[model samples]
Target: MPLSAWRLRLLIVSLLTVSFLGALDHTVVATSLATITGELGAVEQMSWVIVSYTLASTVLLPVLGKLADLVGARLVFLSSLALFVVASLFCGLAQDITQLAIARVAQGVGSAGLHLMPQTIVGEVTSPRERPKVMSWIGAAFPIAILVGPIAGGLITDAWGWRWIFWINIPVGMIALALAVIAVPHIAGRSGRRFDIVGALVLGVTVTAFVFAASWASAGTPGTGIPLLIAAVVAIVGLAAFIAIELRVSEPVVPLRHFANRTILVCIVLSTVIGVGLFSVVSYVPTYIQMAYGVSATVSGLVPIATVFGMLVSTLVTGSLASRSGHYRAFPIFGTAAAAIGLFLMALLPPGMPLWVPMLAMGLVGIGTGAYMNIIVAVAQSAAPRTDTGSVTATISLVRQVGSTTATAIVGGLIGVGVTAGLPASLDASTLTPQAVAASSAAVQAQVAELYSSVLAPIFIGLALAYAVGIVAALLLPHGRLSDELEPQPVVGAENAAETATA
Candidate 1:
């Protein structure tokens, strides 16, 4: 069916609303992790909750996206949203860390659909000329969710308990599901293509292994030794097999032909670096705030507000500039420089400094993050042919997730090292407590704060290094813009008929 412009817009918005919930929940539970750990008696497994979700999401992103293209995005999206709601309920009701971790994996699987399907929907309805503007607007929702999510979660967790973090998704998901069913246009996939089952399994195991290794090592435990080694070896083998398989398959999950485009390859690498810096810094900032200032969970949650504000403003400005001038080189260049500078400044926060200083520094980080948000995707898409748009978008998403996961592992390890190294040798590891140590009159609280501060600085500096890598990658990326005819178009025969009948 030939869809009217208004109807298409309605459909896209409805889909994005659902998409926003998926994206929002990704970080909502982060700040409340401590509370969850205490209640569940599993503080050590805290990072796994975060890692499992990201690992699940990262592994499935490209696979699910390819499946959407093979089957139908409509079915995948609705089913994923439904699963997200159900999984969230399970997460809220979980009696153990294992249950919570499993629930998170399910949520992550659902998130893959949420992250992918909407972009497909957007592409189907909007024209190439309008895509940048429309994409810029659609992108706004994700950041907006990020900006408010922590505050919302903090309030909910503080008032109702951490369980509400999962419970909150129920209403939001229901609304999104209702809207998606009503307005979303049905788009079918290319038939006769086999879903690369082996490839998917390899990718899943590799991601899970790598994530597990990172989380284990970060826990400052000796048990992680064998697992980390095994994970690394398996990931290397899995990746090699995937590359070999993709090159031979007629309908490969990852289109190797696209890699031939030097520009797209460079952009993917740069995005990976950016993801490392962005997620590591954003994910751990609250921990720093909590330790450095001894702030309450609710108050510490506000620390990210500065970063969110900066992102909001910079994104709007840069997006408009790109749309109007059609020149995109400066975004990443300025973004990387600003990010590096911001991270360096953050590292320099003197011991016991007031909260405002670090908050201001986060604002700078946000500026850099916002500046490059869509520029990477835009460059990748423009470098590819029209038919490759979905894969191209999915590629960047996958790359970013890998980078973020790697960074989380690296930074978490660094933080652990700093904390461990700074502790007095006379202190007992198993029964250590900030207050109890302080009572012993051994300069306990001061020493603990000092160790945390020392550790935090190096993590921030590594994040700066990641941004520097992104700058180099951005410089290497080829220059281009979207074509005039890039807007949404109907698939020639049956799919269009299905859409029309629905209309």
Candidate 2:
């Protein structure tokens, strides 16, 4: 077989490694975010640190998938890896928040491919049935990397420096790239496919506008509210125009029609719902702990490893079970139900509860998350045609990002509202660091902590509701056995694959 030399295990490791790098960078700075912003003298701009990378990555995900479908996944992967490594170097060297954010944007562009290519590549070499097993290993990397980031960031910042976090990507990315080049099979792109340049451009602007509008609105920085409104209007208009353009174009950046499929529609809805809640929990809980506990970033980061641990257990168990049984629908339904319970418990916690309480609650959510995302993705991919793999995967990722971005905004807004109404003047909610809060008067510290916990409680409650909705969505997923064998490739495409890899 053409894929014999590719070594399935090695290919899985290589893809996981690449995806892990992207996932790591997207979140590595989170635990150290306050520290990074404090040092750069732009604490007010802190959310931008995460938002910039997320925004850039969110917009590019589907576009890169389309490009890979047109050119080659290997070519896109290699180029993206090279770009990510270089951008990381600049991110580390950045002297100011602006410079750091700009570097992060470049890094995000590369991150999009790193996050997307593994899903795309798995489609290349493995049967649909095999992917649950392989993706269980590969897909777990992104979530694990995301969860481990705070711990990694805290530990690194405690010992080395925050800058080193970005710098570390260079060596790891290089190794992943080298391994992929040596081990991964080349899958040829569709012949004579016309790239949808115009549609792609419109999509980029639309996504950017929506993300920024959400960011600005969430921050609630006085003068920025109007800009957010303007951005929102632009985003709405862009969405309408982008849809119109995509429909008119011979080859749309996103094939909107595929969205009509019940499986695709349900999977996307699930992605959006799960993505909103899960990404919010992953992004904010550590920050919440750091602020409320007045603990160092290291300790704050450590607690969330339980989330990583829980996710680890679920992904391995569910993935292995689904692969052998060829049944995946139950996982998402069970997972979302479990996650909703955990989140509800999170919302119900009393003030001044022990640290371990949150650790447990968040861990439960992780368990649920681990089961749902991978299974949902596999089901969606299985339902789509073979030729539609990359776009479909990209669409899933893009929609998930959109959900994440929306959740981020909603969470941030909730916190902002709390700060405005209840926070004392003595406490600067915008620039809170664990170290700074520790030095403040005990009364001020307690007030700040209480306010934060109060605000976060509702956010969790809201997320619990979202996951509850996901349960119904998951139930709607199609239940049929995925194919046990790989779909046969066209003879011409198969022959050109090796040639394309070399070229």
Candidate 3:
């Protein structure tokens, strides 16, 4: 039996809440990192707070998807929510940075399911024609969370304390859990399929090694040179091993045949490029605003909201349009072009211009980012066989994670190189701070601002080039009506039928 319209709506809300919580936690933690470190007294291990969560989340994505297929999506989703809530409690109670890091790893394990299962559920519930609209809402939660996080983190830290950031999730998690219990259907999982344990281990190791290497390289922390090199070598070897293992496995963690479809390959490539371009803006623009304009962190954070608003509007509108027309290629093509234009405008803006100028530029980039978000995933999911949906979705997510990590590393390198090249030899470029710039003489400030502007121009230029490549990839995407394929297996069990009737 199909779900009642109201029940379906409630289920979507539950899923979106989970998505928002997962996305919000990351950004909130990012905003409060300085404050957390000040009290925790473990500056050396601070980055792991983030790294642990990211590592755990990235490693578990494919495995969780496999579990959902083998067991059930509802079970996996509820388990993930429970783990996340418990981890949040532990994180709030953590007395040391190490404890917090471990708690975060557990949280990340839950987050992997929070992030991926919603889409899987939506796919199971909705036909291909209606998926874009629902997914757009799910996808919008991420950017909205990003937009809201810093502001919320700053306020919460100032009023209550940093721990409240974790504590806050308890109530939200409870409500989501209740709604999930009432609304989610119990779709059966496939039996007799072997879990790809070897492939999972190899891929997990490869991703963890790469994440650590990227973090080290990007951080440029003192005395990490040898460790960074070793991690990089390990990542390369692990990746090779993962590929070999996947090819030979009876049921691979990521099915290789999916890539044979030109649509999936093109979407993957475009997704990588979009990840580079999109994350560059999200990760670096605030720093650019502060350094270039001498604005406070709060004020700098507010500017990205414009981008988020732009993204919100486009996501809803484009998703509705795509749903109606059953066409999606145009969204990515147009969106990437707009993004390239936006990045170019941002790069060209003069230092210390009125705030609105930069906000407008960011809004353009946000539109592009929104366009790519749900549509690519939808395209990739539609392109794959019904049985392979979970694996395919996980693979796309894995590629995007790799792209984001690589982009962060690349952007960090660019900033380092630019600062070194632009600053005077005596400046001790590494020691320079926004306060130092504010305290400098007019001439010095001008010189510093000019250096930052020059570096930023190239960074945005690089971003534009990345989106331009995405535009080409998007053009190559296969054109067809979105597939209306049904799950090959039918829902069974009298108990499930009775539950659906009662709901």
How accurate locally is residue 148 in candidate 1, as Cα lDDT from 0 to 100?
73
Question: Candidate 1's residue-wise lDDT over 1-503, tens digit each?
Answer: 44687886787688668867887897688768899989999987787898778778888888877776777677778988999999999999999999999999999999888887777656545443344455666667677888777777888899999999999899989999998898877776776877778877877787777667666667657666787788778878888988988878776677776566666676687678767887766767776776666665556656677887787788777777776666666788898889888998888886668888888888888889888786566655655544555666788888888777777777867776776667777676456554445455436656766777888887788788888887887776555544444432222232232122111
Which lDDT tens digits does candidate 2 get at residues 1-503?
Answer: 42663488788888889988888876678779988999899998997898788888888998898887777788888889999999999999999999999999999999998988888888767776677888889888876776678678889988998899999998988898899898777778876978998888888998888888877877777899778889999899999999999889877889886576667777888888777888766757777887677677767765568777888889988988888887777888988998899899978876567888888988898899888677767666666666667887899889888888877877877787886688878766567566777888989888878877788888888899999899998887655666666762221222232122111
Overall local distance difference test of candidate 3? 0.82
Indicate the worst ten consecutive residues by lDDT in candidate 3: 494-503
lDDT of 2 at 83: 93
Predicted model with the maximum lDDT: 3
Q: What is the descending TM-score order?
A: 3, 2, 1
Q: Which candidate leads the pack in TM-score? A: 3
User: Which of the two candidates, 1 or 2, achieves a greater lDDT against the reference?
Assistant: 2
- lDDT (C-alpha) at residue 156 in model 2: 91
TM-score of 2: 0.88
Provide the lDDT at 450 for model 1: 72
The digit string of per-residue lDDT tens for model 3 on 216-313 reads 78767789999999999999999888888889987888877766667778778877876688775577778778888878876886668888888888
List TM-scores for all candidates, in order: 0.85, 0.88, 0.93
- Sort by lDDT, top down from the best: 3, 2, 1
